[model samples]
Target: MPTILPALAAGALFGLGLIVSGMANPAKVLAFLDIAGEWDPSLAFVMGGAIPVAALGFALAKRRAAPLCAPAFSPPTKQGLDARLLGGAALFGIGWGLAGFCPGPALASFAFAGWKALLFVAAMLLGMAAFGRLSRPAPGPAPR
Candidate 1:
């Protein structure tokens, strides 16, 4: 309950940023990805702007033992890349190139992108569910 407000605020801000930065528009993203053709470099500025802010956030986080809204900071436990990581990243890049809609922007576009966003989000959710099911360990015999 205590963390709800912060979480909501962060999500709202992220969604607003996506919309304001033109990330919610598939055409804009597709244009940015089209480097050989009519490329749009505006999103580069957006990414450039985000890099510093994210860096600062990580710097600040490093000074604290625990996050403000949580008892501890849960960072990624993985050390190095493997086949699964590489495969996932390749799939993500391919999806971004083909659809011009990653998860964040896809969700942000949902309000105004209409049926297209709906279809994308639906497919994304289905993919996530399928992955969750497939990635789970197989059940074994009960421990004595």
Candidate 2:
């Protein structure tokens, strides 16, 4: 199968899941975060539902010879926490507090006509691109 087909299918399914679980609503997420205020524990239930599904997928993948698309599985092996990681985490927390939407939920929230989500996604993409450039190696003289 084509790569685009799998990507599109995955995105469609993820969007549908977000819609069904009411994750596309920033109000719901904000309520969940507001523990001392009008607290909504519904997000916990969403996590509870997703965790098992994710665990099962992981288990199945481990048992498989190879992923259907690739010969080897690509997983992050980074274990050390560095300045870049900490900075990214701080930015993520600030963004979550200010906008009440992370990247996935922000994109999902777009389905519900979220203006903040559109802004958030645009900024997030820009941030990613900027970080990519910032992390690139500097040009230097090659060895003989």
lDDT, candidates in the order shown: 0.92, 0.83
Candidate 2's error at 116, in angstroms? Answer: 2.9
Clashing pairs in 1: none
Query: What is the C-alpha lDDT profile of model 1 across 1-144, one tens digit per residue?
Result: 989999999899999999999988989999999999999998998899889999999999999999998999989999987999999999999999998999999998878899999999999999999999899887568968
RMSD of 1: 1.7
For model 2, the superposed segments whose C-alpha errors exceed 4 Å read 139-144
Model 2, C-alpha of 84: deviation from truth (Å): 3.4
- TM-scores, in order shown? 0.93, 0.84
Q: Which residue runs does candidate 1 get wrong by more than 4 Å?
A: 139-144
| Model 2: number of backbone collisions | 0
